[model samples]
Target: MNFPLHRSSAPLAHLTPALWRRANRHLLAKAIAEFSHELLLAPQAVSRGEGWALYRLETPQSEYRFPARRLALDHWLIDAARIERRVGDAPAEPDALAFIVECRDLLGLSQDVLPVYLDEISSTLYGAAFKLQRERLPAPALALADYQALESGMTEGHPVFVANNGRIGFSDRDYAAWAPECGKATPIIWLAATKRLAEFSHVDGLDHARLMREELGEGTVARFEAVLAAQGLDPADYWFLPVHPWQWHHRLAMAFAADLAEARLVFLGQSEDLYAPQQSVRTLYNLSRPDRRYVKTALSILNMGFMRGLSPYYMSGTPAINQWLHALIHNDATLCACGFDILREEAAIGYRQPYYEAALAGNGPHKKQLAALWRESPASRLGPGERLMTMAALLHIDADGLALLPSLIYASGLSTEAWLRRYLEAYLRPLLHCFYQYDLVFMPHGENLILILDRHMPARVLMKDIAEEIGLVDRANAPPGAMERIYTHVPDELRTLWLLTDVFDCFFRFLAAILHEQGHFPETLFWAEVAGCVQRYQADTPHLADKFARYDLFAPTFTRSCLNRLQLANNRQMVNLADPSQGLQFHGTLENPIARFRPGAA
Candidate 1:
């Protein structure tokens, strides 16, 4: 009952200058490479005598150069070690924070947004320094580790986004307590929100009482009830909502003090379960009971451009969206054959401060602060000999330059190409089918997908973080009722982006590079295999031929939707959730890598 208000800070003594420099250098290399890819930097190629053309990005104060090889879609392959930063005739180390400040005008960073943006980059560097403190395991060793280990070990934030880990609201202490890389279990505080002010939704067959009994056990429930009764409150009149410990300490206790004092919002103390924060810091996995559902809470921290908060308005339709997706996936033979599964968000509960909601017109900062959702745990559905790991791990490379994909390939006892095929089969086919069959698309980034491994080979894909990120670009195909919220009338050109930008360009681009760099799969072959998978899927489904033609998966080129550009232009709320297409930053076009391999292509 007497947990301390503040936990110890994240260990920072390990952030030696050497580690800090390495972190900054890595961040700078990515910034230069991706910024150039987005045309924010015009890097001229310089002759390097050995037939290698190292490129240079020159600013007024400094010049930076690195060995890079251009790939499809202007993807930058920069050599970090070869990168050189200079300041007025003296060689200088690359500083991530300083680099941003130096290029503020170039990045089009506004006066108001620049400082807060810098804070995010600084926090990101701080996180990288802490990650460097841990023992660097080889790719083979890491591939053998369990799901959570692989998830936490991912060092690169987003391969393209420069300030990927900007958890601005987190104090150094908050970083240690809540950040995923800390690898520590955090206890969550439970709040009983009065029914009148809070909205709770769940699918059929699951209720609040059953969830409380399963999650807290009867003994803890009785204790919580006794506490409520002692405060002259009836437990039946309130719905239990999990509060992020950070929100409680930083925002809730003081901001909503009147509610707590009036006994409308009652603190039921810390739950018995120990949870590990996932890649998206706000969500936590039940380490105590792996089978229990994962809890997603709103921290309201500015991370990777948006306030990482669960919107209360968005919470209302989450369960309905998940149910729609689940039913569709189960009914489709193509998706079932591809072994695609979604971790359905079964229930969501949001607490609204009436005053805040009224004052801010429901878009207030605090409106999103106290909400939580229960998403079905992928672990609960794993069959025998199956293990789960975040899809991000496929791109993970250890300090020794060994990549996890090859190690997984080695462990699968299959040849490199065979392993690649298996992975694409498990992952890519379902995405294509979803687009062609249902006009449905998910935010299929690495962290959003969990790879179910059978003997170290990707067997199935478990999709998560539903309701919020999902979009239906084709409004005509929108199903009736609650599912209608996902509908958006995106232009026909942008519809293909669901696959072209998100899956092929965003995810597979890095994966293909890693596999090739590790000498396992060649870039051409990799894209060819992806092309083969698409063709095979098309052949199998003759009924969907017209749909396939409409949503062409093998177009010659697609819009180069720039991720960092969105952040560079507006670090706070980069993409408007209400209209994602309006927030898109398209920079010319990227030649589709698989264009030549398309069916009937010359």
Candidate 2:
């Protein structure tokens, strides 16, 4: 199957400023050309806007978007021209180009056609060689020679290329030019290959050709041969010219070649873009420092597994949070490495303490290590404020866990608000305020909470244990009374102060730590701004304190009222609360064993 491959001379735009600054002009031009070519053959039409060519494709099921760099090639070309003009030389545009091609939803099709398309286009558009005038072959190979002529003007050790035994070669001096940039010796080219020829060095001539043939395969060679045949050329007599080593590594050039190969054979199509995967959501959960560290470290071990992807499994009748958690863990190794250290410390502490006492008490060593770790290690050391804040965050989980824990506890089909209340009052509330005092805060989206659970409870501690510990569940599965009983027991003024100070303190502490680590002055200034906001809110709104007092007694109303007050105080920016709308779901399903409960059972 053949497809029309069109080349356009439209000026590129919207190159990411970051990339433009880092990439050279030749590289930028090549990247743009490749991107544009891919967009042209994309399943959906491409649109240029705000300095980017946004490729949009739609399958019968979903839409995909890809943004390719803009103005990159043009800028590079222009800069090169300017440099040439400054040196009183005429600008010469090379015929070589680069392109990028991407395929969408290849897995959804009965047969992927991307590889075939790529091969047809590449061999057609970029496979032909230029017929240089015989006299011009001695013109010192254009840019490389000119660049060499200006060697004295360049810094010492600058790269210089020379023709060696009819092949282009780089001197040690030339290799030096790239060393400072990449911190390594650059690979030097011994041959230069144009579209119609295969170049090789005398030192490794036959071996190199054999390797290339093996890599490209007879099928690819045939495709190249067919292209030349179409152009009425004899492949056997065609000379294999040497090309720059950098030319082969260029992303655009490689992409273009790959795309062509892909387009030529249905079996060689590109994979679907990961950035546009269907049924994907980034997951997060909160963690204590040590637990966070352990999770971060443990996550590195799962990178290969994550990249290969995992089948979705149900947890609580929803997709398992572990899948996304694993992905995050794999992505953030820095956080994980620290966690490993903390885990080792905890494990070492556990080895030295509590086992003898547990044995004397007739308890097995099953939990001896864990108990030791918890008791002796500073890694587990959490101040009152951190614990309280952590508890508060745990409450948010329990608020939802209640729906799942009863079924797990009793194996009953019945769902009961009674069981949920009993669990919340007896197990969850007592520890709610503890998190506040501990100055614990959830990560931005609360997705990091899973990491915390995975680290702490791991295997033995069930959700019920957590619920019971936090006072969400009563010992005998009895109701602890109304919401008032759960929250009203705490003094109104004290509750108000705790909530205000705890929330603000957690935010401030986290912001301060991150800012200080980043070494940013604005972060310090941000803390000052937060401090000023607190003072201004308190002083400007005399009713704020009274509102907090009222909300403490009317727990639900008070929580909302406090949130509203905080929002107003912060110029109407919404504050997060333990609310259902924050992607927190309470429904239980058949597959979730935790959601199955007996009637009248906790």
Candidate 3:
């Protein structure tokens, strides 16, 4: 089988000024819409007609007007073409950087944060331009595409956050070689580490040698061991770890110089199997053999609010968390009935540098610099005639202005309403059960989930990014020990906001808007379908009626926990997952779209 890998001499061919202007216009539109939703920049209503409205936002340096339709959850669906930017009565081109600089005070960006935030916005625009040039697949063709295609084809990063693809540390060459949107096949770098300094953990049925033998083939493992044996070192005392090639050259080479000099960390070269990075950036999928488990490595790059590194101390108990959660999900009839399952993190290995370990306080970048985890691939979970697609693709609109969601819905050969019903059941039903029945909540945003499409209709969904992202609202029920770190205590009034903000606002707000614009699917119909999913789930399980009422999904309003606000406040460490509600910036509340769909609502 021929892999779709290529080399290009002209990586920056996409950076034409024409594309730059177009990218900035699109980005400015996004900034306006998202910032408006967060209430950082209030756009006064200028006029209203039909469903859309004209609004004007006055900043100190500029007055901007854009046509936007206010959708459910205060979503400002702005039209990029009609947006007008003026500087003291003279029309000016809309540039995202200039817009940010002009509205820095309005955005509550401090003197230091403003410059760094602008850098992020620039990197995001750079990625957007690259995508505009190369991501050529139309939504209709993408409707029948495979999993990796859908993953890379996704144009929007995190739907709610404007500075989503700000890979701050990556250079232009690194972007070409490593960015998921580049669709390049990269080989994972393997390193042999002494067991004394490194920790290897896995589920019951697996061990280090077996994992190595399976992952790097027996021949390569033997070759690696022979290198160790040649150096007068015992291969038995060491464990093999997979790492991102970029991290090896960038962070490990210099930071872990002591380990390299002491022969504690031996770089064992690249593997024969090539892996393509997923949207999350750090996690890579094996293109050489699709059935192989994914390799998630620590990357020091600051992206989307945090330095993307896996904490060795925190990751040690990942397999245990997965083992517990997998059993819990399987034991329940409802989760199984919905065909919901998770891609388990089967094994993990983390190296602790003594110097950094002693010097660094708390879970800083130095402490989290060298670690990796292997998660089960969704390929093995596919049944006959089923294919995998990232839930993010549902919100993707290609450069041609064609949307993939409508394409998939149409390709399913079901009416819009019927297709949405199947989708809600596959993706949303299990989430409801997890919250109401078990008091569990996951960061079930689009990228954290995979949808199994049986000919374009979502059959079931697989949730990943586990162990780190999932939390138990009932903190008392958390498994004692390091695993208990997943405990997140939300106030009783704010429990439902987890679902409302994570699933509804973060994901569905954009999804409903796309459907309305691309497919003419009414926003009311979408919310109604969502309401039906919850009603059916509750009706089936009357035992959880009290819990459902207490944490009502159909509540009139929920706190607007802003994603960009967290990033704006501090991109380095956005929100402490251990204490999630702390330092949260909630301006006000958003009216829940499903409130009107309640049985007894006015």
Candidate 4:
């Protein structure tokens, strides 16, 4: 069997000997170092055999011996190159040289020209990574047209006929949007068919049709098989499919048993894809069973949260949901990591156009809303304080954040205000340290002092546009302190705007909307409270007040006056359900209980 070779610069031909030697030395040193770091054992005791590296580690957990193979090295090399490409430029330091060298070695290029190669790879990878992650291979031995038909049938409400060139043509009547009479037609059928195809292509050593009958009901399985028979196909030819739960429940069960059974002949609904080759058919079957409790538990572990719009109780009642949720969740992290690797590896190949197109295509209307919001409010407009507030707002809207919030709130039982205070305090206290360490100077209106004080008293002020504020702090302004102090604490990468755009802006907004829809007012209130705190901090800072007065920037309407206005608005909206737009105006002097004695309010 021929292993596919990745493309590299032609000049690599001249350096193949040197490259191999370098790779050997590098691999040996890397293996030893990894063994030492992970096992805490001397590298000398480690031994390498065909496709395996044996080493011993001392740990209370267990005496660990990791098995490493040459094949695994190949995979790792590919994965590392991909990661390096994704990360783009290496830090401009001697320590970063090893990373550059490793990337070069993977591509069979010399270290002398590594920087040039690295630049090429980074630009290429950044463009295509997101799209490639979504591409799924067709079931093995299934014709392209068949795959297209299968996918069309899954997504659209009708069975698709495949035309030449792998395009799926659906009758106008079958178009989901065009046909209204087919009330809530099962779309999962198509999803199931596609999954069956995927399994057939990817899995091994299984009777696909039998598994389908067992998983889907016998009647449905027979109909699916009949459809395949009519198409002049034998079921056994497709026996490599791996069963994924999403497809099985939504579409396969609804399809004719003949079609289902015939389709199953080529697919294995549940089996190892890339990992755990030794896993038995029975083990895979057990994991894929609709009744398995392990599915939700697995999903929670893998995705760092539960399925969206699904509850633990819901999972308990629905075996299909449970099974699919488990399969997806269990594979989530590994799939994510693999996708990242692919993006990195492919960067050098100059195929970013397709990747970017895929991302734009995949993101739905919700993402479109986020993109609009991002464009409407660029980070350049806000100062650090306001930017951080925006970040908080964005975080509140994130899907993962929203999904996990109810559980967290239920577990903590902290009132909305207290939760808001604690969360803001946790984020801001560290952020303040970052501000000081970065030596970011304040602007006019005492913004810096206000921000500092707000962090000190998180409950008092509200923070909006936090994302924008954080963006305003210049990298060069970072305090002259240990680099570790600045970089170590945050959960995700803080050095770039990608995290800001993707996680903070997009995902967070999604979370916030989900929470709002779910009637999780406490989460929203918590965000509002944080925003309020920030605003108050800016208002009360003595330096800010003095600067405003000295510069004649102070309006007759003071910071306290603004707070009073907001307080009145809140009370009118909450207590009497009064509209702020109505004739009743806040004179900024009403002694409402909520507004009274509130710092920075008159």
lDDT of 3 at 533: 92
- Give a tens-digit lDDT track for model 2, residues 1-602: 22111111221221333323223232323222322222312333367655345544333333434454322111111111111101113322221111213222322111333332233223222111100101111211221222111111111110000000010122233222221211121222211123221122211123334533532346645665565566555555332211123222332134334323433111111111111100001111111122221100000001100111111110011111222222333454432332311111111011111223435543222222111001011224332322211111221111011211222223322233332233233222222222222221122211111111221221111111111011111122223332111111233333432333333222223323323323232333533344333343334435445542353321222121121112112211122221212322111111111111211234
- Candidate lDDT scores, in order, read 0.83, 0.23, 0.89, 0.26
Superior candidate under TM-score, 1 versus 4: 1
lDDT of 4 by residue, 1-602 (tens): 12111122231232343334333233333332322222222422278765345544322222323343322101111111111112233322111234334423322344443444343223222211211222222321111112112222111110000000111111222222111111111111111233322222101222345444443557656655565567676544432222223324332344324444544322322321111100000011121232311111110000001111111121112222222222432354422221111000000000011223356654221111101000011222333443212112111211111232343334345654565465544443333222323322111111111111122222222222111122223435333322111212221212221222222222333333334444356334533564454444445444444432332211222111111122212211212111112322222221111222344545
Superposed on all Cα atoms, model 4 deviates from the true structure by an RMSD in Å of 27.5
Which rank order by lDDT, best down to worst? 3, 1, 4, 2
lDDT of 1 by residue, 132-209 (tens): 776656788999998877767787767778888889888877887888877778689998999998889887788899
Q: Ten-residue segment with the worst summed lDDT in candidate 1?
A: 1-10
What TM-scores do the predictions have? 0.96, 0.17, 0.98, 0.21
Predicted structure with the largest lDDT when compared to the true one: 3
Collision count of model 1: 0
Model 1 misplaced regions, further than 4 Å: 1-10, 48-51, 362-364
Judged by whole-model lDDT over C-alpha atoms, candidate 4 comes out at: 0.26
Residue 221 of model 2: what lDDT? 54
Model 4 misses residue 457 by how many Å? 26
Candidate 2 worst ten-residue window by lDDT: 158-167
Model 4 weakest lDDT span, ten residues long: 342-351
